[model samples]
Structure formats: C-alpha cells, structure tokens
Target: MSLPTKTRQWILASHPTGLPTYGTRTDTFALETHDLPALSANQILVQTLYLSNDPAQRGWISPPSQIDPKRLYVPPVQLGHAMRARGLGRVLASQNGNFAAGDLVQATLNWVEYAVLDAGDPAAGVRKASELPGGLSVTHYLGALGGTGLTAWYGLVEVVGCRSGERVVVSGAAGATGSMVVQIAKGVVGASYVVGIAGSEEKCRWVESLGADKCLNYKSATFEADLKEACGDGVDVYFDNVGGQILDHMLANMKQHGRIAACGAITSYNGEAVLPMKNYFDVVSMRLQIKGFIVLDFMAKAAETVGKLVGAVQEGKIRVGEENETVVQTAFEEIPGTWLRLFEGGNQGKLVTKL
Candidate 1:
C-alpha cells in the first residue's frame, strides 16, 4: 500500500583497471542509497526483482574492444550512476499509458531495488513479465526466454543458417548465451555434429549433457589437438561467443564456405593485451562469412524467437538449465560477487540471483 522513499543502488565508484572484484575492490562497484524522484509525464517506476548479470557488464568499465569496439553495443554508464540491467520487475507506479501499477515487466532497470523507465526509447524497453513464455524461474528473463535466447536464435538460425547435417562448433559454450547457442544448433537447428569449447572439465560435461557430440576444455594442455580432432570434417558453422584466440583456432580449421556468428567477445573484455591471430586471412581462403551481431539488432523478432524457445523447452526438445537442472542461484545481495563467478568459470548454467 505504501512505497519506500529511498532505494539502494550499485553505482560506478571507480573505473576498473582490469576485472572488477565485488565487496572488496575499490574500482568495482559501490552501493549507494538515493531518494526516489517524482516521475515525468512519460516515465514509469519499477520495483526490480531478478537482475541479470552478464559479461557485457565487463565492457562497461573495460576499454573498448581493440579489434572492433562497436560490436559490444554497450551504452555508456557514467561514474556514480546506477548500474543498468534487464530486470524482471513489477511496475509500482506509472505516468505512461504503456504500463500500469502491478504489471509484471522486464526493463532496462537498474541493479537498484527500484528504477524509472521511459518505455518509448527503443533501448529502454519494458516488456510484461507474464508475456515471456517459458521458465523454471523468473530468471528466464535473464536467459533462454530473454535476450540470451534472442541472440542465439537469430545468430544460429539466421546469421549462420545452420543446416541439419552441418558440423557446428560453439566457443564459450558454457556461458548463458553460449550454452543456448549449442542447444539451439543441435536440438532446434538440427545440426549433426556439435562441439562445445569451454574452460573446464565440468563445463565440458555440461555441454555434453546438452547433446553436444563432444566438448573441449580450452585451458587443457592438448586443447588445440582436441579441437582439431573434434572437427572430423572441419567446422561448418562456428558460433563464436568468446572471440580472440578461440575464434582464430576455429577460423584456422573451418570448412570451405563455413559461416560464423560473431557474438560477444568476452576474451578481450578485460582491457588487457590482445593476442594476435595470423590465421584471420583464412576468411579469404576458406570463403568464410563472419558476421558480428548484437542481440538488440534482432529485437523485432523477440516475441517469435522466445515463443519458439519456450515451446521447445516445454516439449522437452531443448535443454536450457531447466530440462537438465543446471541453474545456479544465489541471494540478491550477492549480485556483485556472483558476477565474478562467470569470469572464473565458477558458475554452472544460467547464474542468477533472487530479489
């Protein structure tokens, strides 16, 4: 019946020199309390519930990608400003006709408990939570039924155009988006041989559990040899999620006319030295088509894409942490620390926290 006057938020305290540490580091994030402001004519107030912590947040503080920074499509968040995320929340107040109080919605709300959204901005979109179709949890807004699935659907199906019998390889295959790509490639797109590349044996097993023909740990001593052996007929479509070295390896071993969906490049999001790849010209020799895309580019297809994924999940056709039980959950207060787990390969499937 009554709304709080103050809200807690995580703001940019200082720029991170490298990987930001939660709860301890100075340059990571700082939680600050702010008084709620009155809504404008076209704004709505939201009470954030589940927040999605993604690798893209690394690009927020880290420098632009040295290869081609624009693909990240990261909007700028100035210091002392609250961190923004796509959150499954409820509208507590509204000044716009688009949303009403008590409507469950997903928006570019802040990591804070509450935030204001301008539904008209294409980027600052707010979708009704009840509208998203599939789920074992509300965290689906952060994974398969949200931007993650949208990215995988458009990239694998449209960008790579994977065929039924094609040999597909997915790098960064353990992340939220990467994991979805692997499943969609096999279960939905009908790829014949699917290989996943991640950092650890556990991640590899999770990939295998998702019906991947094989999974390779990129950090292994024989990683290069493993990848080479996995691609018996060479990679037909490579869903590149972690770029840089992994991409170079895939490029060097691709089949002729192979397609690549250039998704996120978390490898270079650390603002560190970038490794050089001499094999990029393989694009010319192999006649490869490497296209970089941001999921936001395919927003128009969100409903249809999410609907398909939801149906697949419900029918037991796709595995997205629900069918196989791989979700990792934590408390709302641990949001900052929980994000660090992704970079370290410490998280299992979709790492999310309850509000």
Candidate 2:
C-alpha cells in the first residue's frame, strides 16, 4: 500500500498557563497537516492505532520555564512539536530488518497519524502483538496488559513488596493503573482487605467491581470517615496515584512500617499548589516506607509482567476494560479535552484516541 500523502498532527502551540486547555488553540496543542516524508534506512513508518492520554503527558509537555527545574520528570515537548505520547501502531512500511509491514508495535509515537521511528529510541524494539487468547483486544498491549499494568505491578509487587493478608488501600482506584493495582492486590497478593478511593459513587462502584473489598468517594462529605472505617484495623500497603491531601490521610492511617507506593501525582500535576500534609510526622511515628518509582525502571521484566497481567485477565481474575470502560477511545482531534478529563477525575480507565 502506498503511504498517505499527508499526516494530521497536533502541534504544541504553546505551553499552558496552568493545565492544558481545550478551547482556543493557543493554550496547548494545535492540529496541523504535513506531507509524508521519506523513510530512511533503519527506520519504520507506523500509522498510529491507539494513543494513550496520561497525566505524565501533561508534565512532559508543561513549559520547563514555568515548572520547577528539579521537578520535571520527562523532557518537555518543544513548542511547535508534536505532542509527546506513547501509543500502539501498525508498521505500514519498514526499512529495518527487525520489523516489517503489518507488524504491531508500541512506541513513543507522537500525537500524529504517521511517522518514521528509528530503532532504539525511548524504548526500542517493536513488539509483535500476537498469541493472545481469542477475543482479547490488542489495545491491552497499551493498557492493562501493557505499560500501564506493568507500572501497577512493578509498584505494588516490586516497589512496595505487597504480600498476602496485608490490608491495602489504593487511591485513584477508578483509574487505569490504580484499578489494576486493586485487582493485583486482591488476586495475586490475596490481601485481607482492599479499599479504593475514587471521586464519584459510580466510579467507586466500578472500583469495587474490579475486586476492591470496599470503595470510597473522596468527594463525599464523609470521605475521611469512610476511608477510616474501610481500613478497619490499619492499612498495610497504600498504592497512591493521587498525591495531595489524600496522601496525608494515608500517611496518618497507615500501620507501623506500612509501605506507600507513590506512583502518579494527579493532584499536583498542573503546577497547582500542593495541599499541606499535617500528618507527615506520621512517617516517623509509623515507620512508613514511602517509595516513588517509574515503570520503565522495571523494563528488564516488562514482557514477563505483561504476560502475567494478561493471564490474570484471561483467568477472569482481573476485571479490566480494554475496549470498554477500562479504556476510553475517541477521535485524535479530541485529545486535548480527553487528556483534560484525567485531571478532572471522571475519565474512564485509560484514555486513548483512535487515529
């Protein structure tokens, strides 16, 4: 098949004043079209199939000048550059021996329809997505059975060392990674009690359905009391996705020597002022282990972890939505608003856009 004449791309118009805004193209990404360029040797041209919209994307594209230099996680997308993102795509053409036409791959595909990817960049090696149980979506390679699930696995199993009979609490339980953590805690770790904190009653129900023994709505008036009641005895492991006042509460309620896995900080992402944690002193009193980790740190075992997550899904243990609620898919043009939903706290599971 001949390559497309032009590719639609979302160029970063400018850095956001705070969080990225959807209205008015100046605040964040602006859509642009470009003619397809030549595919040089050792490069593979891919058509983006699914694009992941993550909170980290916000931090990665935030203006470095406005953000604290020390706090920057990933490299910021340069102005007028394609918005940075990870995605699953199909190799339409290739000049590399390792990859070929019709191969499915996951890579640092920009927010564009098509691009040429050089070997060994931002995670090399295009994985051949195959050999899954019948009826499973390949999109899982980007969500539950991919980096998202691996992040949850690495943080809970490797970083926090979750064990059987431990009482676990998960913040942002309704999210893509957090929901996976709840399931892993319930099935793999056999936790005595698994509680999740979300923002809405409906989302709380979804969290519970995903295997949490209990779920609490942080927006409710009795959220703190409900969380305390759900913990009952004490929380042995706290898998935190949102880092703000909830973290302070988790710190205070944690059992002595309990482990806290600091994964994503959706609470403080847009340069918003961080909430005061009056209970940080509990870190000393409770001997808490607050550890922060990046999923890529465990890439050595990425394939292995992804296979295990897939098995759990196949075994009917981990209830994740790859094409349904677990992942929300939309047109590529809606990415700005779709990403903004992550901070708004109502987005279903992982946010992905179909190109």
lDDT of 1: 0.79
| Model 1 C-alpha lDDT per residue in residues 1-355, reported as the tens digit of each score | 8876788888877667677765533657887789988888878888877777678777766533332345446655667788767777889998989789999887888778888778777677777777434436666767877877788889999877888989999987877777888888888878989999988898799889888989999999999888888887688999998888888889888999999999878777766677999898999999999998888778787888788888998777786556322344555566777777767776665666557
Best-performing candidate as measured by lDDT: 2
**C-alpha positional error of residue 174 in candidate 2 after TM-score superposition, expressed in Å:** 0.9
Write down the lDDT of every candidate, Cα atoms only. Answer: 0.79, 0.82
RMSD in angstroms, all models? 2.7, 2.1
**TM-score leader:** 2
Regions of model 1 farther than 4 Å from truth: 22-26, 40-42, 63-72, 95-100, 119-121, 131-135, 321-333
The regions of model 2 sitting more than 4 angstroms off are 22-25, 66-71, 120-125, 322-329
Quote the lDDT for 341 in model 2: 76
In candidate 2, what residue range of length 10 has the lowest lDDT sum? 320-329
Count residue pairs with overlapping backbones in model 2: 0
